[model samples]
Target: MNHRPAEARQSPARTTEVGVRYAIVPVPVLSLETVARRTGLHPDLIRRFVALGLVDAGRDTSGRPVFAPTAPAALARVQRLRTGLCLNYASIGLVLDLLDRISLLEAALRRAGMRSDLPPWT
Candidate 1:
């Protein structure tokens, strides 16, 4: 599953250009191993994120997992949510579920010119 974020897929030349000003740097790609190293997590835990549908994988025909450049940072957040917040895996599942629902709602809210401070927002 070699998926890319919308902006990256849209522009191959520059990630995002500010008209004539400059281009926003696109994040780099990270393999699962690197993600583990960067996140200080066991490789098994990284795989669990994929199984848990927490992080999306990059484009790859092989079964190996490749992560987006931003994934290490994102996984770090999940790590905090687990360790710092003391949430168990089951709790994590529920929280993730709520977050997904909130994301869907937020898109609708944005289209309606309204916003709320909520889940996966920060």
Candidate 2:
């Protein structure tokens, strides 16, 4: 019953002009309402977060904001920092920036074959 070509039975990888094999994966883009529902936060609160630059979003063709799939997790992190640490939005932004910087530095250290836990002087 199989009349398809042999290539159709294999993985969905495609060969480019450069002979590079790659799979096309579709990334999900969430709307503002969807992000709010997933994060259990109000749409207005999500808008506030967006205004404060706490979450990253892109405007769709309709001029509505769209978020990455990670937006919910990012919102959760923001909530945790807000309640658990009792930090304001501004402070949370600074903390997030520092955390991101630290992560990048750690990744660079890892790529350089150095232990991130080691003191800088060491």
Candidate 3:
């Protein structure tokens, strides 16, 4: 019943002369409709989030609201937090703002040669 090859049983990665190279793919800014499609949220929900300052959307050349390529994942996270934690939109917005602030502070600290030895919550 067990007929799997030895290679298949091991890790997927293998040594190669070419080596692995990671390329940073640019995510294009997308319209609200496109964002909604990507995030599986309604356009009206996105608009509400914009109004709440949850998402800072940029404008396209034609003055249409355009979201960053990462917006879908971010919006999905918000949705998860809302449903999983039963949090209101306002609370979610506050949490996101605080998270952003924390990230900025962490980056600044790292840049200043101050590494965090404390636990993550600290």
Task: List runs of model 1 lying over 4 Å from the truth.
Answer: 1-28, 115-122
In candidate 3, which residue pairs clash? Answer: none
Clash counts for the predictions, in order: 2, 0, 0
Cα error of candidate 2 at position 122, Å: 4.5
Clashing pairs in 2: none
Model 2 agreement with the true structure over 37-68: per-residue lDDT tens digits: 88899999999988888887777789998877
Q: Deviation in angstroms for 48 in model 1? A: 2.6
RMSD of each: 8.4, 11.8, 15.2
Best by lDDT: 2
- Against the reference, the lDDT scores of all candidates come to 0.67, 0.80, 0.72
Deviation in Å, model 3, residue 121 alpha carbon? 16
From the highest lDDT down, the ranking of the candidates is 2, 3, 1
In candidate 1, list every pair of residues with a backbone clash.
Answer: 2-58, 2-59
Better of 1 and 3 by TM-score: 3
Evaluate candidate 1 by giving its C-alpha RMSD to the native, one decimal: 8.4
